[model samples]
Target: MFHHRERRARTPAHETALDCLEAGITAALPKEVVSSTVDLDGKTFAVGDAAYDLDEYDRLLVLGGGKASGGFAAALADRLGSRLDGGAVVTTNVDTAAAGPIDVREGDHPTPTERNVQATAEILERAGSATGETLVLAIVTGGASALWCAPATDLTLSDLQRTTDALLASGASIDEINAVRKHCSAIKGGQLARAAAPATVVTLAISDVVGDDPSVIGSGPTVPDASTFGDALAVLDRYDIRDSVPESVVDRLERGADGELAETPDENDPAVAENEGDWHCLANGRTAIDAARDVARERGYEPLVLSSRLGGEASEVGRVHAGVAAEIAAGGDPVERPAIVLSGGEVTVTVDGDGTGGPNQELALATALELADTGTDAILASVDTDGIDGPTDAAGAIVDRESIPPDESETARRALAENDVYDALDDRSALLRTGYTGTNVNDLRVLVVPAAD
Candidate 1:
């Protein structure tokens, strides 16, 4: 799926990293994930471990939003066939022909727009129409928070956009960002489940969070919320962006914390309690990490899954990973030579400069600096499995010891400091581009260490 594979795969190590990435991403593709996790029998429909009697429910409706939702919705439509009734799903990618009976509507990401708001209304309306006999299959995945935008009472689309911009720029974690977003939206944090109350809602999700907490994934539209308005406000305060966000957002959060407004549904809420066990995480970062590890073994390299729940600043994480690779390369202390170290998690970039680059690019660039400084021969590559990194067309970047030449090391460092690694990586033909891979299992990093001569 990488468009510039020919230009980027300069060595065996580079090719191995790319292979591992492909294997990891392919394992999490919505269609592949669904085919393995969901099934239909004579009269029972199964997703994960949950089974529903098709004869008991009068109608089965699909609803959700995310970067991966289009492929997921389409796959579900193909799986359910005529047994499935019509439903709406908002996503950045639209494939009407593939979506079959499901309405795959277009929506924006990173920031919510009027289009997202309107599309979300349709989902909420359809969900609200469900009866006790109706089965609602909520397909929540990464980016759903933005695609499933539904501003709360007295909130406008502009209000949400402004608040989202502030939170994104504040370097807040996904959990922290979703905490604030859930309180400001009408369908997030179990509100969608509340709307479809008594309808036997079942959430089939592809997790993008570090822990795969259903509430944090897609802001928990079909699951109970563990965060509160007080927690959201605390997140803003922790990031020191309380004053940076819109006044309406602060006011709504403050009021909700004061008990003037109802909080997002909790476990005690009847709607959430009824569907407690119905939420299932079909695939997550670990899923991708494991698949990549299998590829490493197949390629004759001893694979080490460093950690599947990695977190923290992207550049810092990159440096630490580089240190580990250096250890393996120099003394073979970690796992001996010819090792492949794989990890998956969502790393954040505290955006300070106007330069364009995503977390994966930043991490890869930072790792390149360490590898160059230590003269490590290992090849390091990182990518957002969704295929888009930051606002750039490149999924991420691949780097080796020579990626940043001795003469250009300072310039490369400056580019990273300015959040401008995209152009720098592009100049070296190191940018890894794979247009939308139709899935997001957070960020995947691969370190391919060659055998010692």
Candidate 2:
């Protein structure tokens, strides 16, 4: 699915890295995952290892919001066909038309908009109307936190927007950002489970968060929220942006924490306990990484999966990856030469300059600089599994020794310092632009090193 695949694979190592990346991304595609995990046989429907008798339920309703919700819903609908009564899903991909009984509504991502608010309201309404005899299929995936926007009664859409902006700009981790989001949102943090209480709600999730914590994915709309409003307030305080955030946000959180308002359902909550066994994660970062590993072996490289939970500043992570590559190239301590190092997880980018770039681009640029400084002959590539890195059109970027010569090391350093890696990579045709890849498991990084000449 890498659109500029031929152009990006300039060397044997680059080709191997791209091949591994494509394997990882394709493994996590929503359609493929859903079709493989869900099956129907007359009145018997099965998801994963669990089976349900369709005849027992009066209606089958689908409801959810996320980047993959559209594709997931479409795939499920293809299997259920007329069995699906009616439903609604919110998503950022507006290009894909609704293919089945489920209504696909447009929503925003990374930031919630008025359209997101409207579309999410419809999803909540459908979820709330579910009965005990109704079987609800919930698709919870990455970017759902922003796409499923449903502001609390005390807060407006603007209040949520300002708080979301502040938290994202603060370079907070996804868990921390989601902690604040759960408290501010009406449909998040197990509230959707509350809305669909008594109904047999089955959630099919494609995890993007590290550790695959159900409570963090899509801000845990279908699962219990272990975090409280006090925790949300603490996140803002930890970021040191509580005062700068919208006043309404602070007041609402303060009131909720003070016990004047109801808190999000925790593990003890009845609705959460009832559907605890129903939540299933069909795919995750490891699922993608495993696929990459097989491709690496087939390509005659020793694949070393460093970790699937890698996180931290994008550039700092790049430096670490560079160090490992240096080790392999110097003496092959970790493994013999002709090794493919892989890692997966979300990375954060602290925007200090007005330059345009995402975490993956920044990491690739930083890795290029480090490899040049250490005189390592290796190639590094990083990309968001969703095919959109940050707000840029490029998925991410690839860099190597040839991409950044010795004379241009200082220029690359300056570009990285200004967080303008996009411009530099664009000029060199190093950016990987694949449009939307129809899935998101997190960020994937690949370092390819050939045997010593």
> Candidate 2 lDDT (Cα, whole model)?
0.90
**In candidate 2, which residue pairs clash?**
none
TM-score of each: 0.99, 0.98
Candidate 2 lDDT over 205-239, as tens digits, reads 99999998999999999888989889999999998
Candidate 2 lDDT trough over 10 residues, lowest sum: 92-101
**lDDT for position 233 in model 2:** 94
List the global CA lDDT of all models.
0.91, 0.90
Supply every candidate's count of residue pairs whose N, Cα or C atoms clash at under 3 angstroms: 0, 0
lDDT of candidate 1 at residue 204, scale 0 to 100: 90
Q: Which stretches of candidate 2 lie above 4 Å from their native place?
A: 95-98
Candidate 1 achieves a global lDDT of 0.91
lDDT of 1 by residue, 97-144 (tens): 998889999998889888898899999999989999999999998999
- Backbone clashes, candidate 1: 0
Which segments of model 1 are wrong by more than 4 Å?
none
